[model samples]
Target: MEWLARVMGARRAIEVGTFTGYSALCLARGLGPQGRLLCLDINEDWTHVARTYWRKAGVADRIALRLGPAATTLATLPQEPGFDLGFIDADKENGRLYYEEVLARLRPGGVLILDNVLWGGKVVERRQHPGDTSLQAICELNDFAAADERVQPAFLPLGDGLLLLRKR
Candidate 1:
């Protein structure tokens, strides 16, 4: 992620899911001194840990954590191009909404990563279960990205699957 940010010359970024801030820390390390990151998560308890680690790593000044529904927070953002990169690792059912919101906010050539897209490999199963709504949502997101021409997309098998997009 650091290499990707450096290569893209990304300065502003948003992370939708900040469980413990490990990913944020990784991305922060690749940013320049003036770079800033906005992290959004609904849980204060989880982000409390993230804050601690960010402070320990001396990157707290560069990251801001917003506690609220991700979709609501994202909707409140100005609908203009600004962010250089976006990471979506939030609720599986809302993945597509997050994708659409982030893609519209991203500048040209921005990278968007949607994590846990495979749902433990249930996306490929022929039989569906009762609690497979999340799986269905992920599959829908995958299909949506694969068919969308506005961005270049790749579905990787890495780390529970990653739907990587480079906005065109």
Candidate 2:
């Protein structure tokens, strides 16, 4: 994430699922002093952990935590045309919607990172449990992203497959 943030020269970033704020902090470190990060998550307990770490990392001032449905929070923000970077690691069923929202707000050269896209190899299975909506959504999202000409997409096999989408 540090490398990703640096590569993009990210000034403002949005993280869809901030589990303990590790990734958020990682990205925050790469941001310039003036840069800010908006972290959206429904878990206040997890966000509490993130808050502690952010303060310890001395980046608390640069990070804001929004506790609610990520989609709703994202929709409420003023349409800026684009953000510097966006990381999606939330509910799989909302992958497409999240992608659309984030992409609509991504700068021309900004990046959108989607985690667990490989679904721990479950995506290759011909048969899957009906309850595995997250995996199913991921599969659909992967196909959609691959065919999207607006962004350059690459699926990397790193920690359960990370889909890197760069807005064109």
Clashes within 3 Å, all models in order: 0, 1
**Angstrom error at residue 160, model 2:** 1.1
TM-score of 1: 0.95
TM-score of each model, in listed order: 0.95, 0.95
Candidate 1: tens digits of C-alpha lDDT, residues 22-64: 9998788667677899999999899999999999998898898
Off by over 4 Å in 1: none
Which lDDT values do the candidates have, in the order given? 0.88, 0.89
Instruction: Please identify model 2 stretches exceeding 4 Å from their true place.
Output: none
Q: Superposing every Cα of model 2 onto the true structure, what RMSD results?
A: 1.2
